[model samples]
Target: MVHSSDVCQCESFIRYEKTFGVTHFYSIEGVPRTGPTNVTILNITKHSALVKWTEIAAEDRLGFLQGYRISYTDSSRKKSPAVTLNASVTSYHLTGLKEKTTYRVQISGFTNAGEGPLTLSQPFSTPKYDKGELEGFVIGVCFSMTLILVFAPLTCCLVIKR
Candidate 1:
């Protein structure tokens, strides 16, 4: 008879033969396991990045994924808090962001199994506003055009009367 401790570490079976008996042993290993799959990010904007990932593996006995953790750093090297999202949710909007600032973002999925690798997004900048002087210049030009149009005809009429 083959003993449990007699099994080879290489997973090879050991067979013992005797004059009137034979013993056989089978070695098996656990199935290979995989974590989350098809993880991706989308709908990226100046203030937020949306993340999408496939369901956990069928063999995965881990509980439902709690949420995603989103982290970011601004151009000035300022770090922001980790943004959390629900397991059922695949999208979120980050608001109150500054305009014309560059931001770098990363995301990862979390569950009882563990946290996944952080997926990074391209650096993006928020939309910038028009210069105040430029806007004032446009307004002034419009006002001058309106005044000329209003008085041009009156001036011509007075000249003809004289």
Candidate 2:
């Protein structure tokens, strides 16, 4: 026998009838209601980048938080390997990336229940090679070639005169 008033007043509950009798289960366990906030990229470089985000609020995380999941894709739309971070980690450093390429990243919180909704993908571009270092190498090579062109002929003429 069951009545509306007899139901447990919990945030969430389940009721069922077994072979023996009626039973009720109550639990607050659920996936996070909202994704991480303030997702930002920093310290972008030729081959690496740093990503950070705010943690899900306590009230929003309905279950025991286990960790976070990060997914990224490059401009070519190829998905990179997803990363899972500890619950205490609010930032991550991505590595082994191509220079001057654009990437999009998304983050979501996971609990004992499952992964929550993902944040909108955030985009960032890696920096290209440094021009100053390349220019210096080119200049050094040109100077060495000029010296060889001038000195080689002079040395040959002196040897012929001898």
Candidate 3:
């Protein structure tokens, strides 16, 4: 199901850049302004980092904001995967980070116009891995077992008519 709000306002035209010649144009709309006036790393877990940020002022958005591109780098690679998020979303969790590793993060927005400014964040490191001990493992198994015990009987009764 699609909603009216989800429908985008778009147009098509060929425009020439100052340096480059005419470029292909299709489905062009207004684009967001410089993204993320403030890029903050809220928390750094052993294998993840939680990032939060506020968007640029509305006036900066020349066109409607479609979404954002969040990128960061760690020790293993010079570049990280770009995560695309909705414009309304102001926070995100970055997973698969290395333990006790620092990373440089950047945030940019995209609109009908194109990609906006990239806000490079200060280097931040993931937290050291802490052995959670048997407490977490035991609790997880117990929880799974409880659910299976409760559902297994109902599933068997429905499947095998005795």
TM values, all candidates: 0.49, 0.69, 0.59
lDDT of 2 by residue, 49-106 (tens): 8999999997778777789999999999999999999899999999998988999999
| RMSD to truth, every model | 12.2, 10.4, 16.4
TM-score of 1: 0.49
Instruction: Report the C-alpha displacement of residue 77, candidate 2, in angstroms.
Output: 0.6
lDDT, each prediction: 0.59, 0.86, 0.76
Candidate 2 backbone clash number: 0
TM-score winner between 1 and 3, please give it. 3
In candidate 3, what are the lDDT values of residues 117-139, reduced to their tens digit? 88866578876653574578888
Ranking by lDDT: 2, 3, 1
Backbone steric clashes in candidate 3, count: 5
The weakest ten consecutive residues by lDDT in model 3 span 1-10
True lDDT of residue 90, candidate 2: 98
**Candidate 2 stretches greater than 4 Å from native:** 1-26, 130-162
Point out the higher-scoring one by TM-score: 1 or 2: 2
Write one digit per residue (lDDT tens) for candidate 1, span 29-95. Answer: 2221333355554554544545455544534313345666667788898988988876666555666
| lDDT (Cα, 0-100) at 71 in candidate 2 | 96
Candidate 2 vs candidate 3: which has greater lDDT?
Answer: 2
